[model samples]
Target: MVTGVEAPLAVTRVGVVGLGLIGGSVARTLVAAGVDVVATDPDGATRAQAWDAGVRTVGSAAEVLVERPDVLVLAPPLAALPAVLAELAAELPRLVADGGPLPVLTDVGSVKAPVRAAARVAGLEDRYVGAHPMAGTEESGFAASRDDLLPGCTWAVTVAPTTAAGDLLRVLALIAGPLRGVARVVEDATHDAAVALVSHVPHVLATELLNLTTAAPARALALGLAAGSFRDGTRVARTDPRRTQAMVAGNADAVVGALRDATRHLDALADALEGGDDAAVTAFFDAADPVRAALAEAAAGDASPRTETVALGEPGWRERLVSLGAAGAVVARTGRDAITLAVPPPSPK
Candidate 1:
C-alpha cells in the first residue's frame, strides 16, 4: 500500500542490470540510502566495485531475477536493449512459478517510446514504466559513477495507459522518497519529443562545434582562447561517441526535426552576420533576454516554488499527472488520496 510522502522507501531491494555510469550511480545511491541493491554487469571489475559499495553483485540478469528485487532497473546501452529484454523474457517463467509477485521493470534509457515498444514485444509492458534521469556526466563506466548524482536532478517518469497506479507510486518512492530528486510524470511520446530538443540536438551541436574548432585554420590559437561557452557547449561531446550515436539513433525522427529547426535558426543568424545587420543581431539577443534572466533566477533560487495538493484516483488522474509535469511542476509528495507538487519558481518578467 502507498504510504505518506515522507515515509521511507518500502522497497526491500532494487536490481540493476548494467553497472555503467547511470546504473552504477543508481546502485550506489540506493545502497547509501539503506536499500539493498543486487546488480549484474559483464565486467568483473565493475561488479567488484559495486560489491564493495555494499550491493550484492551477481553474474547475470537471470541471477538477479531469481533474487526477486522489488524493482528491476534495466540500464544497458540502447543497442543492447532488445537482447536484454529477450533475456528477461526467458527468465520470467522461472520467476513466476515461485508464486511471488514480479518486479516492476523500468529503464533509464534516453528515449522512452522505443524502449516501451521493445518491452511490449517481450510481453512485459503491463508492469513496465519508462524513466529517464535528467542528470549524468559525459563520462561512462562504473568507476566514474557517483552516488551523489541523484539529488536535485529531475527524473522524467514516463507512463502509458496500462501502467498500474501502484507501480507508478513505487518508482516515485525511489526518486523522491530516498533519492531526494524531483519526479516529473510525462507520457512516453512527450518525453521523446522534449528530450530531443533539450538533449539530443545539443549533443549534436556540441560535437559539431568541437569539430569546427578542431579544423580551424588557426586551431592552436582558438584552442588556447577557448573559454566557458566553448567548454560548456562541448562538454557532452566528450562522451563516448558510440553510445551517443546509439542514443541519437534511438530517437532519430525527433532528433532530425529538432536538428532541422536548429539549422534554420543558425542559417538566419549567419545571414544577419554576413550582412552586418546590427539591428537584426541586436533583436535576436533582445528577444532571448527573458529566458536568460529566468534561467539565472532559477540558478540563484531567487523565487521559491509554491506547493498544493493535487487529487489522484479519478478516471482521468493519470492524464492530470502528465499535465503537471508538462507545466514544470514536480511531484513533491504522493499520498493515498492526493499528490502534492511543487510548482516551478516564477520566470523573470
Candidate 2:
C-alpha cells in the first residue's frame, strides 16, 4: 500500500529519542504537520523546551519507548547509535504487544553502514531504516534546531539488506511527510562511502587547515584577517570535535580511502609545481573547475553561485568582510550570527 507522494503510512504518533539538533528539528516538523510528537532528551532544560514547544516530553529514551509510539526516530550522534539501538531492541518486546507489529524505527545518524550493521546485530534490521538529512549549521543541540532545516536538503535514506518493504515505506513516509526532503534511496555502504568523500574527509581537511593556520603566527590576526575563501573552506571545522571524531571513527575505512585519493591528487599538483610545469598545473585546474561547478549545481539545482557561512566573531567583523566585497567577496547575510558570502571556485586560468 505504498501510496505515491501522499505518504501511505499512518504515523499518528512519533516518539523521538535524543532531542539534539536533528531530533528537535524532526520533532518540530512533525508537530507542525499535525502529528503528535513525544520527545526525550537527557538534558532537563531541553526537555522543558520541548514541552514548551508543545511536544510531550520524557526524561529518557527508554521512557520514550514506553509510550509505544507509532514510529521512533533516533536522532543521536553516530557514537550513540549502537547503544541506543541496543536499548531499543531490548525494550521493544516488553513494551509492545507480542503479536503487534514492531514499531517502525529510523535514525538520523550520518554514517549508515555501522548503524545498519548494529541494527542487524540487534535483530532489528527489518524495523530500522537509516536516514541522514544533509543539513545543519555548526551549531548543536535542541536550541539550534529549525523546522525548515531539511526542506532544501538532500536526505539520504538507506535500506538494510533485511529491511522489510513496509518498514522501508514507513521510513520513506517519515522522510517525505514531515521532513519535506528529497528522499534519495541509497545503499547503506554506498551512502557511507559517498558521505565520507563529500563530508567526513572535508571536515578533517577543514580542521587541519584551521589548526595549521592558527598554530603558526599571530593567531588572532590570522583569524581576524581571514577572507571569505578561508572562512568558506574552514566552516565545518567549527563543528563539535566529539561528533566529528565519532563520524570519522565510525566510517574510518571510507574516510581513509577518500583521504588517500585526495593525497594522490595533491601529490600530482605538488609534482607539477616541483617540475615547473605550468601547463600541467593548468590541466589540473581545467579538469577540476567544471567538476566543482557540476557538483554545486547537482547539490543545489541552481545555476547561481554558491554561498558559504562565516561566523561574525566580533563587532567589527562585518565591516572587515564588507571591505572584502570591493576586492571581490560576495557577502550575502548581514545581521545573522553568521554571514553568508558567495565564494565561487578559483578561475582555472
In model 1, the runs with Cα more than 4 Å from the true position are 1-9, 302-304, 345-349
In candidate 2, stretches whose alpha carbon ends up further than 4 angstroms from where it belongs are: 1-4, 95-97, 217-225, 293-349
Candidate with maximal TM-score: 1
Query: For model 2, how big is the CA root-mean-square deviation?
Result: 13.4
Cα lDDT tens digits, model 2, 156-229, are: 76764465556656665676666666555556777788888888998999989889896877988888889998
- Tell how far residue 142 is off in model 1, in angstroms: 1.4
For model 1, give the RMSD to the true fold: 3.1
- Distance from true position, residue 291, model 2, in Å? 2.0
Q: What is the C-alpha lDDT of each candidate?
A: 0.83, 0.73
- Residue range with the least summed lDDT across 10 consecutive positions in model 2: 327-336
